[model samples]
Target: MAVRPPQQDGDEPDTLEFGIAALSPHLSKSDLTFPATTDEVVRELGDPAIPYDANGNTVRLSEALGAVRATQFDTQRELLDALHPVLEEYRESGGGILSQLRALLPF
Candidate 1:
């Protein structure tokens, strides 16, 4: 379950804010807060332990740039290969929630 931070009224800017920034143009003034630090932000959201290095130093999300590194593996290809048979099975079963979800995928 994703836990959102408590909302504050007109506490800070959009870019620097967390929950509000994520919800963006859709968020109301009542749904905002002034998070003093990244720790505060993380605590409010009930996130799991922040990623860290082998040295036990806390790793900031911005600093962990390599986390998004692309690999030789093709994610789309892997997903399609794994899901095709399950989708086929759902179709043969006269369709259900899995079939509906499969239909919604851009693939």
Candidate 2:
């Protein structure tokens, strides 16, 4: 996704958008729903080329959230990481332009 930082005058940033992978192995038989898994979520929306400070390290949401709660970093990267997949899912499920625009807003 094109993640634009907040503007100086407190206005919204330019659009940030990206594609998510299809729900494949995670899909269930009933209605083809996929259980939200960290790996699947990350794989679908993560920027593989982007460098992570922890390098090859990976962890589940619970673990990541725990770390965040403990103030591992001043801010939580996991929140941003988690939002991408959800936004992708909403877009793919036929969310309109307004909805997409809302999703692009910084938290």
Candidate 3:
């Protein structure tokens, strides 16, 4: 099943959304404490799929966090910074001929 984002009370998205900024909403929850490990973040957020590529294909939060260098993040800013490069790299890995071929396939 595709992952669905939570509905916001307002139409405007949070301004903290800059890099893996798609994740800002998930990370901003009061229930989720900071100084979290990647695993902790994944667990808290329920491993939702994040849009990763230029083509808008998504990978699970856990899957994308796999490539992040920092295992622990003291704050949301630290986590977002660590994830920025990883997400950027993932974005570059898509929208190729193979992806196009996959779109044509029945599965």
Candidate 4:
């Protein structure tokens, strides 16, 4: 999905987009769903790639979040909630040219 930053002074803002990995359709049903915990995600995804800090030391997910004063949620609803702000930002960015053109139509 793509999201443009808020417009300013009638000028368009830069567009930002994120990628999400989808499971292959050919995969068996057993590999399609995730377990009900973050720990399971770690096991399934095989240990998230650790990022390095300014000091060149690897940082864990919690440590990275802590550095930015942020935290992660594990529950489904909570996970969606955590993503809400970003969704809102994209919503506010308005649809692209197609949407604007559609608005100009009387039908």
Model 3, span 40-105: residue lDDT tens: 999899998777643456667887788887899998888878877877766676634766678799
* Per-residue alpha-carbon lDDT of candidate 2 for residues 1-107, written as tens digits (9 for 90 to 100): 34454456656536332321112112222232134344443444442422111111122333333323232222224444444454444335534475456658896
Highest lDDT, which number? 3
Which residue pairs show collisions in model 2?
none
- Candidates 1 and 2 compared: the better one by TM-score is 2
- Candidate with the larger TM-score of 1 and 4: 4
lDDT at residue 32 of model 2 (Cα atoms):
21
Error of 4 at 54 (Å): 42
TM-scores of the models, in the given order? 0.21, 0.23, 0.70, 0.26
* Candidate 3: segments with Cα more than 4 A from true spot: 1-19, 95-101
- CA error at residue 51 for candidate 3, angstroms: 0.4
RMSD for each model, in Å, please? Answer: 18.5, 16.1, 6.8, 16.1
Index of the highest-TM-score prediction: 3
After superposition, candidate 2 runs with Cα above 4 Å error:
2-74, 96-107
Q: Which scores higher on TM-score, 3 or 4?
A: 3
Q: In model 2, state the lDDT of residue 90.
A: 39
List, residue by residue over 6-97, the lDDT tens digit for candidate 1: 45767733223221122223213223244223333233444322212121223232222123232222332432233334333322443446
| CA lDDT, candidate 3, residue 76 | 82
Clash pairs detected, candidate 4: none
Put down candidate 4 lDDT per residue, 1-107, tens digits, no spaces: 34555567656536533311111111122332432344443344443323121111222323222332224444534533443443333334443365456658998
